[model samples]
Target chain A: MFNDFINQFWPSTVDGLAFGSIYALIALGYTMVYGVLRLINFAHSEVFMIGTFGAMFVPFVLGINSALTGLALVGVIVLMILAGMLASAGTAVALERIAYRPLRRRGASRLAALISAIGASIFLQELFALIVIPNVFDRPQQGRIQMALPQIMERTDLFSIAGHPVKLHQVVVVVAAVGMMIVLDRLVNGTKIGRGIRATAQNPEAAVLMGVNIDSVVRMTFLIGGGMAGVAGALYLIAYENTNYYIGFLFGIKAFTAAVLGGIGNLRGALVGGVTLGLVENYGAIFFGSDWKHVISFTILVLVLMFRPTGILGESLQQARA
Target chain B: MALALGLAACGNGGSETTPADGGSNAAAPGTVKIGFMGDLTGANAGIVIPPRNGAKLAIDQYNKTNPAVKIELVEYDSQADPSKAVALAQQAIKTDKIVGLVGPAFSGESAQVGPVLEEAKLPSISASATNVKLAENGWKYWHRVLPNDGVQGPGIADFIAGGAAAKNVFVIDDKSEYGKPLADAVRAQLATKGVKVTNDSLDPAESDFSSVANKVAAAKPDAIFFGGYYAAGGNLLKQLRDKNVDAKFLSGDGSLDKGLIEGAGADNAEGALIGCPCYIATPDVTDAKVKGFADAYKAAYNADPAIYASEGFDAATVFIEAVKAGKTTPEDINQFISTVDIAGVSKQVKFAPNGEVEAKDIYIYQVKGGAITLLGKAAEAKLG
Candidate 1:
């Protein structure tokens, strides 16, 4: 096992980081929402899911027959990411308004909100499975089967580390993930809206006393988080090259685990936690066997929760979360 | 409250619709119901749907003869889950009162459904469940239509060593009951054949194979055997080719669907070999009985017959034979099913005392020019 790990360490690390990048991006959504409202935002996963479908719909509908190159390729990638963001961020805000706001106004229990989020997640997945894919996408034959996108971006190998040749998509996934996280960090710590967000997260009642509109801050929180998840979703479609209704659930679970591992409400915690989990899973797959991948990562989660209880970074969306 | 209620009601996967051919033909002296059970909608539904349609076609053809008792082929969609299979098996035994059963198509469901069918003394002939231990259950009423993993594994192992002439082979399973057991069989056989084999597992539902693909690249085997369904196998194969592993890829009947090619794009899937006890009817199949069944199936469902369709057809024939012998109740039909010897589309339909089908050829198929083309039996096919 050690020999196998030693031989393939670089390849495994690179692969793990790329995977971690996806988990990290999605984890931001879960973490940001939890930081403000103390809500786990189970529906955030569905928001990410919708983004993936939104990303490629235009290209699929208009029939992108020609191969894109240079500026055209960059433009297409931007358009895909923007489309995904619009769909996901819109869904997140709408979800807050339609599903969650009503419950909040009613002064419903936190359990009620959690249940609603869980319910909405299933509803979104099944809606795509039973109705949307068949009727809207015009694929009536096998609604549950994956809709694989045509390979638009050419994925040539740029270089090799050890024996593992790094492909274009893998590089895009890691670089885009890191770049997005930095932008997010700057956004949350730099602007007036960022100050308002930190103030509300630190003390909701005091922030309200300081003349911050709690409702607007919450909405902004979801919009930013959902947008980040949307970018992740688009990146996911680029990396995996396919989308299915059931894709979100597994990714959601891992991202949530990442959130918890990093300290549920802390933004930076989600990044480190996600990358750590991804690395652990990859190394575990190599050392123990691919069969024990989940067991090893999940056991690590249990150990973290048992000992630290708060998480690796400890909980705080205000200061240390960045 | 409404959200919780909605969640509670969403466990079942697909809406159950009785075939139009089944319902209106019960004008004979007696009406007997036989259940066709498997996943009609789910991830693996592509492989199951053809067999369901084929079974319906057989029952419809029998109903055309205007016999004393009309046969109703009721469908029990288990969605390929074992717990669901157990519940559906009970529903078939209790509410539907099906005299005979044609399936619990996957291996996991068959394991769960076995004791229930045995307890009820309801005779069942599965068209596609090929776990070898299913036969070890001592279930008197259970019968199979194809060769189990015990035969398929060694046959594939022999082909890898003798036909393809590979010394180093990498074996991967999806880690389901169906995949793991078959993979273990292949690994055990490869050992006897003096081949160096490395083992690993992946879950198809997870939809990421980059980590596993990387490991495969590092290990660098000459040939790769994946014991799983087409979706994961194809995706994994695609990633392997992307990483330029270029190992000779082979999988069992589980990965034999056209969906695999769709998953791994045709260029990458080219030359990927598959071993199966189930025979699909392509245009090149000159056998009259197979050709006729394919045409009849196309006319019935407007679709081509795929893997296990004929096995489903043959399983339904045994139940039809039970009806022909004036066996209407479950006990009489269960007893009658064991005695029937009939020539069916795939082969002569007969069961040994252990309820295993007669040993048949495990055909080797190669993905060529984006089409799954037959390459005769495992013994004859050159893996080269």
Candidate 2:
């Protein structure tokens, strides 16, 4: 009985991790931004969408063919990734400048800041609807040669170990996300700017008094978070093989939930929360059937918040450094 | 923006009194306009856009051959949204001056637009709408060039029961109007074959499905039939395999897309079976006209033409034939269409009293290395 259950259960757990990777990637953006600015980047999903749109656009507009050498292919992909990152990061910065900057200047409360994030999200979604593929005659041919980076990020095969099939993409997503979190942890604990950002997040007044340029720190936070969302968007397109104007709504909400579940305003908490949430949702669906997957995930979220508002990792922003 | 496009097509008709279908016979003073409603942009556009392009090719060719018959094609993007579909139907009938309409490719949109077209007394022929109740509504002007899910689901179930000799089948639906009805149809037919049926429902929006996979694997069915589009079907197929479910994966037309193979991973989708309601790929007929049409469609769309394109061409051909048969007026056209029979790209086109096509051929296919290979074919003798 145990062997049979292990045979069935282990593979599902692995698949769950694969999906968790994508959630973790997007959650990183939510956590990092919240870690520094204490504001949820509601427009982060749009950033992901733009990244996918950009990924598809490169090979199409540039007229790249499938016969290119490996080096040439890498060059084109690197260029596409850079362009997508720049576009997403620029939009994130601009959104902060236009939507959140004014509110911040007015000394908006957390509630007002949250509202501004909501407003920005709506605006960007509408912009996509009217100006992007939804209204356009044809979707921008989203790059030449679909599934361009198959070797690095393909969906996992069915049951590799013990002849059990598994999705490759789900596993890659989880590992990449966890790997990214570890790198982020190292950067935060090891780097000088990490100390400054930590100080700013802990107490902005003290950081300002200590001569930290809070504006630059905030800008860097948006850039890194926005960059992560862009990467997530690109990865999502590879995983799903289709991109649409409204692809960001569910993912954004889930990532936010993950951030909250891990304890909002804590970076490591976000990573842990995202993977755990993804695993829980996957396991819940497997047991109850997929119809109840979201209900199960959200119910866990509500119960967790009610039981321990500080989240699984109870360390607040101030306590993290202390 | 959609309204302007409609008026622009009609305003180009040159005269308000002459019918667009008049062809060169009377130099047709008005546009013989056929309106289309579909998701020009959005998730389903990949399917809808190619058919529209094929229709355009047919229209261009039809106009060239029959100079007297100048049919105007106007389109509105419903975006696969039901409310938008309703609004578009109203505009197509009231403002576009369309005598006939084709499309709103999805089953859900067609359900919403059915009554509106019926009230307008405008005959609408769809190339891809497949719900069974769509034709059962007693809408006088409604017709479908493509087969309904009733024919498709049972046809596939017959293939599974007869060909695979399967006794236990698990049916799953994404819980949408399209998925649920199709699954029910397959389930009903499978039960008739003395096959045991286990049913499951899924939410299309959710990305994960480990728990469901565990349960499905535990059920230990011989096969699984998914009644949803590729989006969720791909993930479900992958996770089912992860849970070590060795059952043969089966689904209707919704699961048939290149994206499914890629998204589900070729490894997971291997040995999977799918069926589409139309089989235009058969070489049973060697008509030069069909080959020419196929070549033109491939050249224009950069994708292999499917039964939907053939159905779209047939819809256009039927309209032209109606015009030539002294159906210049809307009433005459309606009368003419009810009795007309013409060789379409799919088969000889003839509609029953309720506007359902009388004959259909469903094609069963299997995915091997991310390629759809024809497995078998099933045909219907008649529709009730």
The DockQ figures for the candidates are 0.56, 0.29
Per-residue lDDT tens digits for candidate 2, residues B11-84, read 33333332343112222364477666666555555556656766766776666675665776666667677877
Q: After superposing candidate 1, which stretches have Cα over 4 Å from the reference?
A: A64-68, A320-322, B1-29
Fraction of true interface contacts that also occur in model 1: 0.47
Query: Which candidate number maximizes lDDT?
Result: 1
Query: TM-scores, in order shown?
Result: 0.94, 0.81
Model 2 segments more than 4 A misplaced? A1-8, A35-38, A51-91, A106-172, A189-191, A230-245, B1-28, B66-69, B206-222, B234-247, B259-272, B281-289, B295-304, B328-331, B366-376, B379-384
> Each prediction's Cα lDDT score?
0.84, 0.71
Residue-level error in angstroms, candidate 1, position B50:
1.0
Candidate 1 per-residue C-alpha lDDT over B262-289 given as tens digits, one digit per residue, 9 for 90 to 100: 7887788999999998888876678898
**Residue by residue across A140-235, what tens digits does model 2's lDDT show?**
431111222222333336346555565655554555566666767777667877788788888899999999998888877777677667767655
